[model samples]
Target: MVVQTRADVGDKSQERIADVLRQRFADVGLDLGDDRIRALAAEVAGA
Candidate 1:
């Protein structure tokens, strides 16, 4: 459901959400852990 929610958002909105999620992961001690993945996600979101 969360993945779907992310997927459904507009590109810019998705990037914003992704940023927030990544930050949250960082705070929790296990980040999403890949710059490339984050960049791809951002690019997809920004598409």
Candidate 2:
């Protein structure tokens, strides 16, 4: 299991989280772009 702190995600802002996620996804061979990642992060945050 991978454990992550808020700082690992680049703070608690949804936008920042999305940015980190975009790069991470790319690192894992996922082509999820910034726009989609940001949108998904926002949804997760709102939930």
Candidate 3:
């Protein structure tokens, strides 16, 4: 979602995508760790 959003907005920076993922997930009630979220974001951004 984050990567798609980045592509939609013409922003592909991994750091920016990670930041977006963090902010988006922060509003959710998920139990994932920050490190895990970052890893997922990196993986998605790399793809």
Candidate 4:
């Protein structure tokens, strides 16, 4: 697993974070839904 901070990705929006997470998951052949991705992104963003 890899980890990155908001500064690393250069964006703090939930949509952007979700996109990053979505791509990372896809890199490993795993697909997540929007709701799940958003939830995870929210957690990552501390929302």
Candidate 5:
């Protein structure tokens, strides 16, 4: 899923959000890798 946030969100915050999302997805049996989630997070963060 694409997570859109305010452009002001920092890179580190985006990464932390992505990490949480990764774990949540994993808990549901979806194994979206770090690279993919990180990319999505960055993309939405407008990085």
Candidate 6:
């Protein structure tokens, strides 16, 4: 779980990381599609 909302960071990179995490979670049978998981991941990974 990671999100980069830094002013110096790009949105695309952040999105890519998130998408990877989403996929990873799905692969492991986790529910990354849930808004709560996404929000938590955003907080944990975002700046």
Clashes of each: 1, 0, 0, 0, 0, 3
lDDT of 4 by residue, 1-47 (tens): 22563545535887788888888888889888889888888777778
| Per-residue lDDT value at 21 in model 5 | 63
Residue lDDT tens for model 6, 1-47: 23332332324454654566667677778875657555644554553
How would you encode candidate 2's per-residue C-alpha lDDT over 1-47 as one tens digit per residue?
A: 01242336533688767766776677778987667777767654553
In terms of lDDT, model 5 sits at 0.65
Per-model C-alpha RMSD: 4.1, 3.8, 2.8, 2.5, 3.7, 5.5
**TM-score for candidate 1, residues paired by index:** 0.43
Q: After superposition, how far is residue 38 of candidate 5 from its true place, in Å?
A: 0.6
Compute each candidate's TM-score over C-alphas: 0.43, 0.57, 0.55, 0.74, 0.56, 0.47
- Return the top candidate by lDDT: 4
lDDT of 3 by residue, 1-47 (tens): 65565565334666676677776677775546778766866776665
Clashing pairs in 4: none
Q: Give one digit per residue, the lDDT tens place, for model 5 in 7-35.
A: 33435577776776676678779988888
Give each model's whole-structure lDDT: 0.56, 0.61, 0.65, 0.74, 0.65, 0.53
24: Cα error in model 2, Å: 1.5
1 or 5: which has the higher TM-score? 5
Two-way lDDT contest, 3 vs 4, winner: 4
Off by over 4 Å in 3: 1-11
Better model by TM-score: candidate 5 vs candidate 6? 5
After superposing candidate 2, which stretches have Cα over 4 Å from the reference?
Answer: 1-11
- Looking at model 5, the pairs that clash are none
- In angstroms, the error of model 3 at 45 is 1.2
lDDT of 6 at 11: 44
Candidate 2: the clashing residue pairs are none
